[model samples]
Target: MKTQTAKEIADNLYTGVVSRFGCPRVLLSDRGQPFMSKIVKAMCEILQVTQHHTTSYHPNTNGTVERQNHTLAQSLRTYCNDTHDKWPSLIPGIMMAFRRSVCATTGFSPFYMLFGQEMKIPFDIALEPKDSLPQDTRVYIDQFLSNIKMSHKIALQNEAAQKEKDKVRHDQTARVRTFAIGDLVLLKVHKFPKGQSRKLCDKATGPYRIEEIGPNYTYGIRRISDHKKQASLVNATNLQPYIRPDPTRQRLSQEDQNIPPDPDSDSDSDPEVDQDDEVTPNVDVEATQQPTPTPQQTPDPATRYQIQKVLRGRRKHGRREMYIKWLDGSCTWEPDTCFDQEMSDFINSRWTKQGKRRKSYFN
Candidate 1:
């Protein structure tokens, strides 16, 4: 516990669980270096314990452990001396108190659930009467077994009810988002260089293309510029659709257009041109000059690309966007305003046939 080295962590795990309770069937932990290192893996293999890790950068997968850690930290802060050097020695007392405390989800203390009886604290021993144990070992074993079974059943029911309440609370603000393979997205930056100000640095940094879709809202992404894949799969919560800027708007803004000078303005007239030099025999020249053919209408560059299909839709920052698959087999996300009335109608018809709600853009 003094250091987070792989050997130390593995030693502590073996001493803590194997010595106290025995080898567990499964070990769930975050993707920390100490937990994922070869030393820990070897230990788990030797103990025949299956190891599972939470998703990268996602702490909610191990929410129960995280919450307990938070509680432990709060307790340490409250009870530790001003120097905080003795905080490590107080962990055992805090842990015991926690195990005896009733959990809101299970509605029963962990001690009672595990041992089939409430723990006898100093206060209870002094103030409350203790019940006598059964004389026969068989009778006591049957009672303990029955109590354990009944307590487990009730605790499971309470846990289920609590989970439903939590789900409902979460669903009130949760939005469903899905991504397909080849979709472009921005990956959130979880770490910055040491001494760099996080507030000034960019929060998200990628125009990464999704290479593969995985279970549990995860995706394997690669950088678009270099095609370099990420080392670990990224969760959906840390990615946003990458909307490419319109090239037409940028081109028009950058290029200067020629404008004819005002004929009536004094600035247009050449004061040095003499009236005698202006010959009036320009009628023949004017008659010979045929009317210039009207310039052909140039097609809009924005509409040149043909859309093959509308793959999906999502709302980001209050703006609705559709994932468009072009005829050339390329894909990108476009806003609702980008589509003309005819294109909007076509998209709506396709979506309606697929049993999706109608988009309100054209209407």
Candidate 2:
């Protein structure tokens, strides 16, 4: 086929998809030129099909279709010559092979599930006995319908069992994260083009506030810095809880800068009160000396950085340093002295926002 324009795409969709399969309730696709064109939009509006586009960077939303396309391409490569221009001629044979193959989820071939009978392959017709007798018309019709019902029942049971297995495997390593209205979240950013170095690129943008929760685990996000405009719907996979920077750390850092030199220890020393100093009335010395709670240690609403991955066993100048990736956008190496036990474990845990099944545990 030649390069298709907007009108051609719409016309082909109406003839090949709508006419054949009837109107779809919803259409999900990437933001390709054909899908985004005005002609396609008008066709969808007229057909009453809700259109949804996946986010720019996250291609997993349409993973199933991508996988099928990969399968079709592989089949084509096996059937076509080196030139490959005539591969479209073999589409019918490829589709027939696919329809006859049993799916893992349904545990039935697409042709058998739809038509309630095995397709008559060329070999079946060529190798059949010439003297085979045929059954009565009424009896054949009744028997065919009975077999269809049985196949449908088996398909349903297989589908249910597959769903259960997937759920159990997913939940084993899943990290469940729930967001309430008014909660702050960091949106993962994808501005860099393909083939660019992403090692130091900013992975996320915004300490955005959750304006609304939409269906299908999508969250409506708006920038905290700019609340006037609402951004696109973000999937849970691309979002992570934001942990705000701790003020106490800054305060302690400042105090460390002003403290006088400790000639004995050769390291920074805590300020000490002289024995001759008089204690003030109504003031508890022990209470004043207690350490302030950090943002990570408390259930603070202003949390911005949630540690998701930890690269342990790293060293800086022969001292141990841990590299951590946060939910928002930080990937940095830090000394062990900087984090407490709780924070370290949280970083080490390979948690994701969507709670998807990971191969390490699921496999």
Candidate 3:
């Protein structure tokens, strides 16, 4: 098939897939132009179908499609004529063979799973002769319905077992990652066109904050600078934790730590020197002796809110809301317009703690 435009894709998905199988609860696709288009988004919204995009550069997130493509290619290579142009003609036969064969993931043929019976190929016809006499239509119908129910029950059980086994194998190499709502993250980029120097180009983008998390590790993210805007969905593997810098705190200099103590200071005086000449050392006098601890400033009681977190943006609601988690274990949803500059800065500070450095986006 020729490459389709976004509108074409949206129409095909609705008519070809949805019409046949009904609208799915969730639709998963890569971040392709067709999938990410406005029309597709509208279609999903209207259908109430949650759309999920796989992490860029991580094809394994859409492994089912990839695996099927591989299988199809192998089959075509094995059966196609020398010219290879005849491959398209062989598709129906190849699909039938595949449907009639046992699937490794389900332990059952697609025909059996769907229709609750084996496909009546020519081989089956040759083995068993059909009875011409028709009788007891009601009893035959009841028995057929019962067999279908039993077959479906068996298929479901087999599918569950196969899934557990697959999960065990998958988990062996899978790394667990944790992310909080409103946490800034970097997303991997892998869709650059051909012939560009990848080493020189940026491999990832964003410091996007998590707006919402959906099913299957998919997250809705918006630019950290513009959290008020709508966000895009990205899978978990593409996102990595981003630690926003705190400008309020100052870092101690290593050069100052290595400097020798001042010899002229009264604190450097020997035991033979008079006690009256000895001076009280200042806490900031790092070059003299061990630095004294600075007294902690008491925070103002009225302004002291222990915990603060930004939940998400108010893109579509018209009224902006910032959901916060407090230290008292209470969660409150507050209007963003209510926050002053100080409160806004305080919430942004929670994006990263003091002195913690974040990893590079590409890595």
lDDT of 2 by residue, 191-236 (tens): 7768878877788878988888876677888888967535467777
**Which is the better candidate, 1 or 3, if ranked by lDDT?**
1
TM-score of each: 0.69, 0.66, 0.60
Best lDDT among the predictions, by candidate number: 1
Per-candidate Cα RMSD to the true structure, in Å, reads: 12.4, 10.8, 14.5
Error of 3 at 276 (Å): 18
lDDT of 1 at 147: 91
Measured by TM-score, how close is model 2 to the native structure? 0.66
Kindly report which residue stretches of model 1 are placed more than 4 angstroms away from their true locations once superposed. 130-134, 249-363
Off by over 4 Å in 3: 6-63, 81-83, 130-136, 193-195, 225-230, 244-263, 266-363
Clashing pairs in 1: none
Point to the candidate with the largest TM-score.
1
lDDT (tens digit, per residue) of candidate 3 on 32-143: 8889999999999999999988765568778889998899999999998888888898899888888899987666788887777778888889999778898798988887
Candidate 2 segments exceeding 4 Å error: 1-5, 31-33, 36-38, 48-63, 76-90, 131-135, 193-196, 228-231, 251-258, 261-342, 345-363
Provide the lowest-lDDT 10-residue window in model 1: 288-297
Tell me the tens digit of each residue's lDDT in model 1 across 267-360.
2365775646644556643443334222334443334546665667877555567877777889998876687754665566656533355654
